[model samples]
Target: MRIFNEFTFEAAHHLPHIFPDGHINTRLHGHSFRVRVTLEGKPDGKTGLISDLGTVKAAFDSAHEKLDHRYLNEVDGLETPTLENISMWLWRHFARSLSGLAQVGVYRDTCGEGCEYAGEYEIERKAA
Candidate 1:
């Protein structure tokens, strides 16, 4: 079974690296962001549940507090604030808090854009 929880935040950011002197994305702007964390696990024998919904939500409490109403550029490790980076940042911080963490998603509803990511692994491939 799988479970997920989400939270929203309002923050400002700019894509300073995008070229063109007056490119709109290069300008500082605010967005309402929705972040989701997904976990995979089997239902427990006693409770017959994957995990408690409240616990899943609470696991993201630190993330909500850090991202809400802050300038993304100023946040440590979020200087760029792209959707992909945001999802990765959430995964890095909240992975340990919520067991079975499988994926993360970040969305900007107003812009109809989003990104989803599964955590990376250091794969060691054998030569044929």
Candidate 2:
């Protein structure tokens, strides 16, 4: 079975070193970010659930608090804050606690752009 949870956050960021001086990403801007965290596992016979929504949502609380209505560039490990980077950052955060984590999806809804990180790869790599 697979389960997922999502949350949104508002933040501003500038890709200074990541982009050229004349590029638009070098200019500070804000975005409404939508994130989805997916997990996969076999349902437990007693619980009949792979995992509960509460646990998934609880996993998002700390991440949401850190990113919401803030400057992403100021956040540790998020200085660049591109879609790909943001997804990886989230994967790292949630992977610490959620063993079933499968993937992390980060989207800039306004721009219709997004990225998904393979959480399982990181999990397996770490175990190895």
Candidate 3:
């Protein structure tokens, strides 16, 4: 069975390397970032559910609190704070607590600009 949850947070960031030539991103900016977490595993026979929705929500809420209404560039490990990096950071944050964590999708907004991270193995392969 596979279960998914969605979360949203607002944060400010600036990509200094994206467009250094007087681009708008060079200055501080904010976005309503959305994230989706997917978990894959066999449902427990007793509960018939992959996981409890409230439990998952609590986990996401705890993590999102760190990002919400904050400056992404000031967050540790988020100095660059691109969509890709943010997704990866989220994956790492939840992997240990969420069993069978499969993927994390991070979006800048509703316009479909975002990135998805599968796991550390896949990320390592891409780097290689």
Candidate 4:
């Protein structure tokens, strides 16, 4: 079985690079961010517990507090705020801080469109 929890934060950022002329990102922009974390593992045979929710929550809380309503590009290693890149970066952040994390999803808007990653992730564009 799997257990899941979620966190929300707001942040601002822009790409300083990658443009028609290879210019940095555009001017800084901000958005409300949502992060969903899921954990999957078998319950302990003796304890009947996969993992404690408090443990995961604590880690997520710390991460969110640091990121909420801040300039994401100002944070080292996060110079871009694109949904796909942010999703992958978030997954790595949580995986390092929390144990048993199976996957992560990042929502950048109200619509269902967003990015998701598990373990190592890569974003690809498909032909429509």
Candidate 5:
């Protein structure tokens, strides 16, 4: 079984090389970023839930603390903060705290663009 939840945060960023428009590429912009984290696991023998919502909320809360109100480019690993890179970063962070994660989607409303990464916490299949 699988369960999922979404969380939102705000961050500012700009693409350094996308264009020299001065306003779009140079000026800082913010977005009401959205993240969807999906988890999969067998229900606990007694609880009958894959994982409690509170447990999952911890991961989301932690992520918000790190990303919210900070400049994306200023973050440790986000030199550019493109949608694809942001999605990958979210996957890396949240995947460790959950048993199974199906996907992570990140949206940058400023540019009207977003990216999604699937199979983030899925078990790797070995070659036969």
Candidate 6:
């Protein structure tokens, strides 16, 4: 069985790497970012549910608190802040607690454009 939850956060970001080319992404912009967290696992016999919605929501809430109303480029793991990077950052952030986590989807807005990270590949992080 699989379960999913959605959360929204507002933040600003600019792609530094895209600046030299004068891409629009180089200018600071904000989005009502939407995140979908998907978890896959067999249902528990007692509860007959894959996971508790409240528990999953609370975990996402804690993670979203750090991103909401902030500048994405300033966040610890999101200095570059592309859709792909943001999704991967979220996957790492919630995977430990949500062991069954299968994927993370990040929507730039209500638009269909976004990115999904399935945790199928390793992302090297810069040393702090």
User: Which candidate achieves the best TM-score against the true structure?
Assistant: 6
**Local accuracy of candidate 6 as per-residue lDDT tens digits, 1-128:** 77999998999989967568678888888889999999899998998988887777888887888899999888998898888989999998898788689899999766568998999986776575
Query: Predictions ranked by TM-score, top down?
Result: 6, 2, 1, 3, 5, 4
* Candidate 5 residue-wise lDDT, 1-128, digit = tens: 87888888988888976667775767788788988787877889997988777777898888888899999998986777877778887888887887777778887666677787874333343454
lDDT of each: 0.84, 0.86, 0.84, 0.77, 0.79, 0.87
Clashing pairs in 2: none
Candidate 3 lDDT over residue span 9-117, tens digit each? 9988899877877898899888998889998999999989888867778879877888999999988877778888888888888987888888898987665698888
lDDT at 90 for candidate 1?
88
Give per-residue CA lDDT, model 4, range 1-128, as digits (tens). 98888889988888666565545457666777888889899999998978887887887887787689889877665656677777777777787877788888888776556777787756564444
Of 4 and 6, the candidate ranking higher by TM-score: 6
Between which residue pairs do clashes occur in model 4?
A: 10-69, 15-25, 16-24, 16-25, 17-24, 17-25
Provide the TM-score for each candidate, comma-separated. Answer: 0.89, 0.89, 0.88, 0.78, 0.79, 0.90
| Window of ten residues with lowest summed lDDT in model 3 | 119-128
Error of 4 at 52 (Å): 0.9
Off by over 4 Å in 2: 120-128
RMSD of 6: 1.9
Candidate 1, poorest ten consecutive residues by summed lDDT:
119-128
For lDDT, candidate 2 versus 3, the one ahead is 2
| Candidate 4: segments with Cα more than 4 A from true spot | 19-25, 122-128
lDDT, model 1, position 16: 80
Q: Please provide, for model 1 over 40-82, each residue's C-alpha lDDT reduced to its tens digit, 9 standing for 90 to 100.
A: 9998999998878787788778888889999999999887788
